[model samples]
Target chain A: MPSATMLPITDVSACCTNVTRETISAENAELLARSLKALADPARLRLISIVAASEGAEACVCDLTEPLGLSQPTVSHHLKVLVDAGYLEREKRGTWAYYRLTPGSLDAVSSLLATV
Target chain B: MPSATMLPITDVSACCTNVTRETISAENAELLARSLKALADPARLRLISIVAASEGAEACVCDLTEPLGLSQPTVSHHLKVLVDAGYLEREKRGTWAYYRLTPGSLDAVSSLLATV
Candidate 1:
């Protein structure tokens, strides 16, 4: 398994300007599409909602699995996709892994949509 | 062939609130996911950006193909998906078809994202 402490480097929002502001470059389209693709799954969308509604916009892996009715590996895979896309951040506290929305992360996507 | 004047009815945005504000229902997740899935492709994203940057946030089918390096049918198909997903509106001008982003349509999706 990869180390849990590494911070995500793909902040897709920062890489693309608002789509409405101009004709997006092909590269930007691919980058933004990658992020949206991560969010396109129903389970992942619900996982984001559940975590965002949790106290402090954070939840442990334990709290997520039961509510999502998915196995730990499946939930973790979805969470990892969100993390790789820069919507969620992961932190290890002793034995459990906690996931939190990157502050204003969802807003970045909303703001991009508004640019149109 | 279908008439171009018919308006879209999906309006997926109005069906769901911010994901951050509540735990999204399974149905809403499916709806939102469907819209996001429509947007997950790079070609579709670029098409939206091009039309949005055009006057009135609109573009004709004839104006889209060259810039996109895509065939007219392909562009039209993507536009139809976007229209069905409630991001774009279609209007017929004589024999040609024009597409425009629904007024504040992008903002509705943005607002939903903020709800998360």
Candidate 2:
């Protein structure tokens, strides 16, 4: 195996092909579909919004549950999905877990949808 | 019932609340979620890309099935979902139905995802 320093760094939120400008390959389409699926839920959307609207665009699990009207377990599950999909980053600070938008993640997806 | 002339015009692609700038209301989250659901499938995403890359950013139903490698009926179903979700508009020409991206639909979603 190559050393860590020899490995190429990949940007998870790197820009994708503009869907309107050209035909996206099957692989790219599948990847994008998965990302969109992670985001295509009302609860998850609200969670992201709440976290985004919080101080410094970050929030703890304790703060999210009440605003979303979702139980802690359910909220944690959605947070996991977002983190797995590269849309959010999770951190454990002492006891509660904090979540924040992954830099450039939403913009990369937004750029893909841009027609012009 | 209101008179035809008195009916309000609704822009299907109207801008939604910025998810990163503020907390999105439940109603708005539901609406946006529905739109994203319609776009969260690989076949449907590929279908959109193919049509958007076609001449004049439009394509006939006949041209879509082949690239998607899906049967005509399946492709038609996906097209219908996109059209119903306001991402594409369909027009029946004598022999076939043509589809094109609805102006501002993608951009509206893009704008919602813009953090800045």
Candidate 3:
């Protein structure tokens, strides 16, 4: 079952196959494409990097705007997208939300692409 | 220098960094995003898998249409996108065009994502 974040790639990867090993089903292709679409943007990719490189592989939403050179709302929007796509996990502490790389999520997608 | 195919991700990776190691530059983010955009479509993903799973990791354009259940032009367009993004290499043999995975291209992108 998918978490509340609804990671479609995680659901699809349960089958343990990759594009290069066999022809993927349309359903799996759609799900994987959705995840790729989430990461296919410049801002989102940058956001992921910033969060990953930060201490503890996490960063406060408050700290994201300056490095991305984007406004707070825009950075929040990208953060939301990453959270929704299951690449990042979000937790609230006091006045701010912090984001961290969801362990192995990137590697799962990486394995898919490398085999292709 | 970029190839005629203009693999921007390859050009960017020449800098010898992955996103997790540091904040990626805006220009590098843009180029990587462009390559990911080419791969963010379901049809294109399926097209790549079919081609990769074919003999010698290559497939003739003639053999692609049926498995994809897409028209020739539609499949051709997706292939063109993959070729332009440097994910696939196109070759002409007599009357038919063949496509094969460009060596190390997917792995390059994979390395970036996994490290992030």
Candidate 4:
């Protein structure tokens, strides 16, 4: 019997299969797609790129704001979306918050996209 | 001077940079993210997976609909989105339209995602 918590996640992933011969349930597909949608914006993409290209592959809000030419609040909003998507991690140092790539997050997406 | 026809697409891609030292223009970021968005749906994700894993890396709409458990029209719509995004190529064979992966489209996305 399937547990209650596990079922919904599986259900979302169950709707589809991976590119591999192994079938990917639609439930898995849903989850994967949701994550992808999070990075679907140009602002978010640039944010990821900027952070990845940063001196430490991490950065704070002030660094992003001027480069993006967007307001602080807007940059904050986009950063929130990235955090929600698992593509980034935000850490606060005193009054400032810094964001960095979550390591394998990109690879997870890449493998999900890979055909072999 | 920028051409009238090129500005909109350029504007969209203008918000991003690649994680490399080389810099990815925001214009490129917008174009890349939109393409990513097209694949962000499970229906579309499965569609790409199926085609990529197909015998000739090609399949028709009919082959896709049943596996996806979606209406033909819905499957058609997703395929059209993929086609519009340059992920899949549609070919007409008599009364039916077949969709196949366009060479390098996936890699284009991968490179955009690549940070080094």
Most accurate candidate by DockQ? 2
**TM-score attained by chain A of model 1:** 0.85
Listed in order, each prediction's TM-score against the native is 0.86, 0.88, 0.89, 0.79
**Candidate 3 — which pairs collide?**
none
Per-residue lDDT of model 2, residues A18-110, tens digit only: 777778888777777777888889899998898888988899999989988989999999998888777788889899789998877788777
Candidate 1 per-residue lDDT over residues A1-116, each given as its tens digit? 22222223245566668878889999788877877888888899999999988987789999989987899999999998888877888999999898988887788777777754
The better candidate by DockQ, 1 or 4, is 1
- What's the C-alpha lDDT at position B9 in model 1? 23
Q: Which pairs clash inside model 1?
A: B18-B115, B19-B116, B20-B115, B20-B116
In Å, candidate 1's interface RMSD is 1.6
lDDT of 4 by residue, A1-116 (tens): 22432222223333434444454567666677777787788888788888887888889999999988999999999898777667788899999999988766765565555554
**Which scores better on lDDT, 3 or 4?**
3
C-alpha lDDT values of all predictions? 0.79, 0.78, 0.81, 0.70
TM-score of 3: 0.89
TM-score of chain A of each: 0.85, 0.85, 0.88, 0.80
Please give the RMSD to the true structure for each candidate, in Å.
4.4, 5.6, 2.9, 5.9
**Where does candidate 2 chain A have its weakest 10-residue lDDT segment?**
A1-10
Candidate 4 docking quality: incorrect, acceptable, medium or high: acceptable
What's the TM-score of candidate 2 when only chain A is evaluated? Answer: 0.85
Sort the candidates on lDDT, descending order.
Answer: 3, 1, 2, 4
DockQ of 1: 0.64
What is the docking quality class of candidate 1? Answer: medium
* Best-fitting candidate, scored by TM-score: 3
